[model samples]
Target: MSDIDLDSARPIFIAECRELLASMESALLRLPQEADKDRRDSVHGIFRAAHTIKGSAGIFGMEDIVSFAHAMESVLDHVRDGVLPIGDDLIALLLACADHLGQLVDSVAENQAQPDAELVHDARPLLAQLNQRLLAVRMQRSPGAGDAPQRKAPAAPRQTGADHWHISLRFGRDVLRFGMDPLSFLNYLQRLGRITTLVTLHGDVPLLDGLDPEACYLGFEVALESSAPLSAIEGTFKFVMDDCEVGILPPGSPVADHLTLMRERARGDPAELQRLRAIWLHCASVAPEALDEIAAAATKPAPAQPVPAPAAQPAAAPAPAPATVRARRTGPRPGEASTVRVDADKLDRLVDLVGELITASASATMAGRGLRSAALQEAHEALALLVQEVRDSALQLRMVKIGATFNRFHRVVYDAARDLGKDIALEISGEDTELDKSLVEKIADPLTHLVRNAMDHGIEPPALRLAAGKPAQGTIRLNAYHHSGSIVIEISDDGAGLSRERIIGRARSQRLLDPGREPSEAEVFALIFEPGFSTADAITSLSGRGVGMDVVKRNITALRGSVSLASRSGQGTTVTVRLPLTLAIINCFLIGVGGSVFVLPMDVVEECIDFIDPGANDYTELRGQVLPFIRLRRLFGVQDTPPRRQSLVVVGHGSQRFGLVVDRLLGETQTVIKPLARLFAHLRGISGSSILGSGEVALILDVAALADITRAAMVSRSPAAAAAEPVHQG
Candidate 1:
């Protein structure tokens, strides 16, 4: 491959290595929880992931990854064979190795020729740990070997004239067509041991005029001198096994096996059989006597018994174990869905084009309405439907399941609980919920902070849990589901819940809350999210400088989302994060205030009503309920005078309801969200901007921020105004 091709392929290799590392870590985590029968499958999966990574890294000439993955694969190989027992210590060591491997892959992503000095230093102990494990396993397997030294002495050199393992390979014609280079496998084989001799055969190659450039018609006979197991040698070709025929003859093997390999390769052609026999005898250094004995035995037919009936034949003979393992590691089974990995930039560009198309479609529709042409209007109505479908399809391509993101918390909870010396288990539900890919990526950090906080602060210690009449092993639950056109993620823990008194006291000491004022449960709980507010008596590594929760709130808010905290005195606490399905475009309820247009996410808008009480402001009675309202004209400082009639759009955010007073109800429309420039980022009550069909820019309202403003406005009202009856607005 050219330098350009290699540069382009490096990202793919890096991405695949990361995915494999993730799979390896997940499998290692599950080892302790799986049953004996199921545990074997997991072990195989982990081994295959490591093996594939090493092979790919070798192809990329990434020596760091290859060496580390090779060491990890050795230990995993023993585990798969039941030589090393599964235990907590082994799993922990392997998880650490997986982490180190991830770091190596990160270096590759950065185009570093090798891991930096710090990473190299970090890898020493991990590699040492792997070597120690393998040494221990070997000691345990050896007969009469007890209390062996930590470091074994080097073995004596191999004697001269020793027989070598002979390997025969004949690649299928389509090998090159599938983007595989035959020499790469041979290079990987060198990692196992020395290849003393290699002979390439081109007997199958046609004349120059008849040859196809893309077809592979070559074979190889290799004399390898190594002590590596047969399985390891076979695994060198695992990725291409389906498209190649491989035969291995170990030293000291019976002559019958060699004869069988030769016959299989030669098929039924006498000339080819003779050619193979001669090559094995001369080139592969096979004994002539052994071949003659095998030939004589094959020529003499043995006495046969009566042939069995068709039904008496064995039904579906078992396949070789190695073949079965390879099958599992290959691509998905028949009838299963396969995926093509696309770059995130490409997906983003596609979404951007779709958004532009939506704007154009809306503009065309508006033009058609002005012309009052029935034919054009009818055609555009159809075009509008098609555009809607295209918009949905384009967005759907970016929608990924949240399960992968949620599963990542398993390791987080595990490590945190271990460090805190607490017994906590993460229980997941509704993991199959789907959300925008962008949201999934951005929400992970916030979710991690929330999870760690729950483990550190929310979940009580084992002794405390027992005293409180709860299970000694506390539980942290991550549940996700879609509701009201939004994805709701709930992270709850069954430990001592948030203490209202403690929170309020902390808030007051920090001057975040007034000393004499009382607040609702929701309001008290929300104080924890205030910057630099903490109820902890002392600082801890995980949290307690009061930095995480505030950032969590800020991040969720920036995503056009809302976070709410609900807790009981002793029951537990649940942090609920609600976010729109996609950030690029949305169905919005457009309203006009003093000739200025604003967009309210359609999901949050409950209903619209005419403002009946013109005399009242800020507070209104909606069907006997005290509904706090914000007048858009006053909020955005629109200079146009209000008309005689105004509209109130009631919207619900989390547990609060607020009404936005506007001058005109524009109904619903599809709005493509365009982010505001950095200069306008500090503006409150507006999350983004959008361009309408009339070429006018409309501000996308931040519903949560507006709700907060409404609450603040209601709280500032005078005692007499508060005591006054709210004007009926229904």
Candidate 2:
């Protein structure tokens, strides 16, 4: 038997640390109030969260975190049973304990067994207060405390059951390097059932030179029969089960199959087969077919079982080893939940290269245009299809649910709202929305600022809300959904709608707006994001410093995304941000301006409209529908002479749409988004570049930026007052 490996134990310590922090964060953010009718459910949730961290830590013998979690869990248990209340004071103490436990877990993960002495000292008063409160509450319980002993504990399972079963197999050396301990399978199996038998497959070991000390040269053929059920057994291998061959071979399987397996093992040695035959007969219950099949297996292959799981993604290069020391082989049978984990960075790098390849392929395909031969034409068509597929795969790799980002904001809302003493709740929607991983990372900070701003300024105090004929508790909602080719995330608060009067007064006083201008509320509210501008009575370090809003706008703009705000006096305020799905390659409907091609991201391109020369169109006929129009020839100043005919590329951002006039419509093409270099990053309406088949570099038009420009132009040319048009419909 192998000894417990300390080196392998380290990863467990690290994982436990991560898990503890997640649990602590999740719990503190969701702590229930004392008067909540469903308080037990809340306390129980906290208990389970702590219990998981403690149990996982216990598996690796990280007693410090486990012990701390135990203390916190005890209080949760009392609260869960209503022996102690879940008041603000208790939640405060428990949250502090959770914080300390996170620190202790981190220390252990970094291999520091002896944490700072003062940490334990700091926890003493909290622990004492916790225990004292639990005791005092228990004493105060009316009759229930005296009757506590009468309650029976939860039922425990029996030691043995018929549904028990086990599987055994030795894996190749390749399996060991993946850091999977063959023994963990046994431990995992035990969780599924009372393991009836475990046998090492010494039959597969090679001689010493062929034996790899670092590699798993031997496998185990295990038999597990359990009543707990088969699904759990399957789930145990859910992560790595595909790496090794797995099947449910019943007891007393075919004797011929066994014999074939044995004969194959014997390798035509008559003496060995004879010995195996005698052992099979002596076993009494060994299947005759198994005995007979072992011989046939030596010459003919054994009957097909499921194939093992494929090695991890992208298949790492095989490490060099002496041929004598062969690695063990493992994988799933033919069909199973067999898969391998791959480093996301590797996938990202591959996608980037594939983008370059698409450009190169497009150029090469275009180069073959002159030949016009049937063979070359066929080859070009095939290459085009292949490149299209590659582009799709690259795009797929960048798609990740917006949920991961949403989950992180829970802690932010919890902590900020608590500090502000607001009974605010954050409701999330459309978390299943997807976006580019890179864009997701950058959008996080801006989202955080928006959420914090809503909590600090947009939402109101509980008492004021109740006085206004509204529920006492305030709500902040974060929602994300697909709109056109972009993802729209909105953070809204049902607080006193942004104070329009206050915003107007502040903008005027700050000289941000001219006096007696009667600026639209949208324009007035936009001033809040101006640097050093805030209408708050007093500034606090948490917010209202006037530093965060500018950063929020700057970050979103850097992403080629836009933020718009809308609010009513009493309804609510909504900050909506629109971001592209992936910042990489895009499916573009290319158009030409003065004969030069330009790609508009397909998601934003609504439809193409053949332009009929405008001859003083009536404002009533097109009043609300005046296509916000931009002239590409004028915007980018293309050199080639413009065609007599022009087409309108109608692009959209939410409900807003605009037409871009170009000389020709170049049809659909797959184009990679190559971000403009730093020197050119500040260019207007040109967000990025994409290469064409002739190696021509086409610019990606930023629809949001173009919309802004067109809107500005429309306003400037308007006969009405400067602030007449509606700007913020948040």
Candidate 3:
């Protein structure tokens, strides 16, 4: 067989291993709370994850991962068999093992053949603990199993008279084409048991002239002397079972069963059947008298007997058929969708191409409109619709559920609660909300900081909570939802809320607020996000450093998002973060201000009205409520005369409504957002730039930033105007 490219498969192995590890960790965390039957299933699931990891690692020759996972699998097996009880201590140990395995997988991803010396050294104590646990259990089962001298003795094989398991392997013809080596599978199988007898079958092979080098035609009949269970032996071929035929019989089966297996393989072909029988007798050491017993039984079936019901079967009856046979016959369940893993870079490229398509379609539509031809305009209109659909589809490819990201915090909360000696529980909702994959990755750090801060600085101790007429366990809730074309995530805690008095006092001490001027509660709470701001009485490893919250704000703002705070003094604090669904392409309302085109996100545009009271500085009355507005002419210094009739576009961000005064109100269009250069990075009220159909670059307005600017502008003008402005309960 041709040598398989191990490098090409390493990434898949690493990704699968990480997913399995995540599931295992999640199961470990929730095992304590699950119902009895569900708890048992969870244990089995964890064991399967470890076993699959070990088997896959063996196929790739990752001996370090294989050995470590094997030890972990052994411990989990005892748990699965009810020989070991589940407890907090056991769960903590298993979590550590999962983490170590994750580190090992990361090492493999970094192209290391084995874990580093330090990592190997780290595994020593963990392995010792696992061995001790196993030893303790074994000693409990057998009184003499734990003698000092006998403890070092190897485990004895299961008591099957011959201790031989017969495995039949018939690999598909395309196995080699798919980069699998049959010999490698056999080599891995050797790790489980000794193969005493092996016979190769070449009956399926074609003539020399007709042979294909890439086609796999060889088959093997193996007699393995193993103490391992049937499932363990079957797991060796788990990865290739879909493309290979595998039949495994436990040790000490009747000779008639061997004949039946031979008949099934031959499929009524006399010559092939006889050939297989001969191999079984001579090569596998089956006695010849067994063939006569099988023939007599087959020919002497005259008595009629009623079939026994499944529930009536005796407990000592033989086990059911192996999973391999059932799986081959059943196939996939109806309506089960298949999935393919594509590199993230590929999806990004596809989105980039779609962006270009949108730009090209816009240019074409502009040309068609200039010509004023009905046919050309109609065709371009259809093309525009099609292009819009393509853009949506392409962007959808990058949209993934936020649940995976949220679930990761379970471990984070578990570890942090233990370290802090607090009773904190995390409650999550709206986890199925979807957002851009890029945002998901970049948002993790900010979310992590927020969660840790909530745990360390927000949640009160159990005693404190109990004294305050609250439950002993403080809860941190993470909720997400989509609103106005943006994803809103809320991180809240049921602890003593932000101390308004202390915050104002800290702000005054830090010169962040006026000493004599009393700011609103919102303003006071906002000061906590400023650099080097903290109200903790003492410094702690998790939060009192006062270094992370500022970074969180900066990161979210960098993603063209906004963060706001709400607190109830003695209740709790909720920090709400709002971000666009995608950063690549967006639907925008185009407008002109003194020959400069500006784009407003379509989802944020409430309505457009005639620019009334042109002389109004920055505030105006709209339908009885005071509306704050910003003039693009003054904001960007556009040197052009104002039109006789201008327009005001009302935009709503969160609960705040604002207006952008423009010279002309152009219609809506799809826009591909391009980041501004470093020279313009500091520009306020503008997020990014886009190319219009006429080839003119238009700036995409940053509505959240503009809202802040409007608020500050109003406050600076006069305190009376600021008080008259409506309070936005964001």
Candidate 4:
């Protein structure tokens, strides 16, 4: 039974451990800038993560994880106690320890009874470093044991006269059956402080015939003398809080606190009330009158009605038990929604169902449009609204903050900076921007490549940056935000920006540049994404291969996204990646070109305007600006004569603008984007196909790709032809 329980809980434990590792890394990364109070909080948080993982690992009997985490927790403990000062060296060592612990957890996840020998061998040096620091702490405390004592300021003394914390614990009957030893918690508590006094109660023990060997029926009243904070003591029993009833009274707590604990503990048993009073009188400095009042209240018949909740306090006292403290840690104090840990597969299944619901709703709406009855149309309209709401909610389930992905680059920048002997600082902004989870995962590798490339090739050495009147430390900024119904991620660096001369040189050498005509600045910048294109003067491990940039463009395009590069010679370089919010389903403007239907993602559709001439010219004047337009019929090689009354669908892709001339506007649609099969994946200006309510296939137009095609066409035309009034023969 124990084995079965452990197996059932292993996955949850692993998931929590991974979260703890991420949080630990984040705290360590921010340690350098934290203030004194913030630093203490950060250290304590790091300790809790390690301690929780250690305790949970011990429960699963993963000794490799427990042993290493125990050591890491010890070092964090010393740091928390102010015995060890935090520094870059210490933080580095701790980060390394975190990595090793992650490896141990991964080993367990791989079904290994023990960690790999190579990993264990690597951990030895880190363990030694940790223990050496711990040993130094102990020696420093011992009188006359070291040459010079380098000690931190003394911790604040306990506030009141009392010095012993009062702890009350009642082990649940299932504790023993759950493989938890009551005495083990006692031993762990000792690590925080000395237990000055203990009173064990066995009143709950059953008769001989009723006793169960595996059941636990013990309680303890302990007086612990220590300077540890209330949070630290509460953390001792955090794992078992749900399984057992636990209460803690801080040193010098008010008599009211003890009274509260007694009332809670003595709910039904009169003997239990007397026993608790006896223990409280022995451990606390409360007067006999307070105990008499509590005893008197315990004996009085409880009110027949349930007690009302206490009113809110302007300045409430801290909670004493681990359970209460854990609640406060988990969520906000008020109006917080209860959350459950749902499996990702479950959420994905819900999204798939929602997609189907949207499709069906569209079909019903289409059917209703053909009906002559207004009542039927109204009903269908209501249903459509409900389905749209459901779809939004479903998509939101898969929208995750990009903070995790952004923070991951901290380590990348750190390692790359060290490897290149450069001083680079990463500044992350808009981390809370939410996007589709699938796009987040797919964009990670490409973003990583771009970030490293910027650091390696775009950013100059620190000396050069200083000479350029910039700060000694180069800065790389990662910014994300929502723009026009899409998520835009920008990776910008305050470094020596892209060199136009060098880029053009490389493009010319690669035969990517047309010698007959000069390219626009945008065209020159776009050359960087050409396959096998690079401007690096020499081959280096990071960037000279020229493979990553082109691949980045391709991958982003695969997601129906676009990547644009902007740079100035001496200012900086910024690579902007624009991606759809969700690829599963979209609201599109369906248009017809010849006999084929096309869907333009509504988010990019600026407006639809009357087309004065279908084929008289390739550019149109919209307001005062020359809007370059692409003829869909010509672009797709439609053999049919163009419709006499065509319409232009104005679309914007980042800063570039273009128009698409269509045969007819089919109005708005709810579309589920279906990826093209491999045989047709190479089709230009089309991302995927969608099935409309009429059972016709509509090619979902790639606005970014079409904008690119427009730009390319403009570049191929003569200057006069590219002008606003140029005439072209079909």
Task: List ranges where model 1 is wrong by over 4 Å.
Answer: 143-242, 245-270, 273-333, 621-626, 712-730
- In the predicted model 3, the residue pairs found to clash are none
| Candidate 4 backbone clash number | 0
Top of the candidates by lDDT: 3
Please give the lDDT score for candidate 1: 0.80
Model 1, C-alpha of 219: deviation from truth (Å): 8.1
Quick one: best TM-score, which candidate?
A: 4
Question: How well is each residue in 1-730 modelled by candidate 3, as lDDT tens digits?
Answer: 2225666777888899899999999999999889988998788789878877887787676788888988998788678667889998899999999999999888877754666667867998899989999888887875655322111111332222334677788988877655466875675465566766667788889999999977899998876767877777777776677787887766545554555566567666666766675566533423344544434433343225422323422234354343333224245446957678999999999999998898999999999999999999999999999999999999999999999999999999999999999988999999999999999999999999999999998889999999999999999999999999999999999889888899988888888887698776667878989998999888887888768888999999989999988888668989999999999999999999887899999999999999886375688878877788888898999987888888989889999888888998889999899999989989998899999888999999999899888766766767676777673532
Give model 4's TM-score versus the native structure: 0.85
TM-score of each: 0.79, 0.67, 0.82, 0.85
Model 2 spans with C-alpha error above 4 angstroms:
1-24, 27-88, 99-340, 514-518, 612-624, 638-641, 720-730
Q: State the displacement of the C-alpha of residue 462, model 1, in Å, after optimal TM-score superposition.
A: 1.0
TM-score of 2: 0.67
Ranking by lDDT: 3, 4, 1, 2
The residue-by-residue lDDT of candidate 4 on 1-730, one tens digit each, is 3687778888888888999999999899889888998998799789878977876777777787888998998788778767799998899899889988888788777873556767878888999999899888878776766523232221331222356787888887776654466876786576577776677889889999998876889988777778888777777776677677777777545555666677677887777777776667665534444455656666766556543323431233554432222111334336857777878788888988887787777788778888878998999888888888888998898999999999999888876887798998999999999999989889999999999999998788988988889887889999999988899999999888988878887788888987665677888899989999988878776788878889999999999999999999888999999999998989889999889999988988989999887356677677767778888898899998886798988888777788898999999968898899999988998899888877788899888888788777777767775664322111
Q: Is candidate 1 or candidate 4 better by TM-score?
A: 4
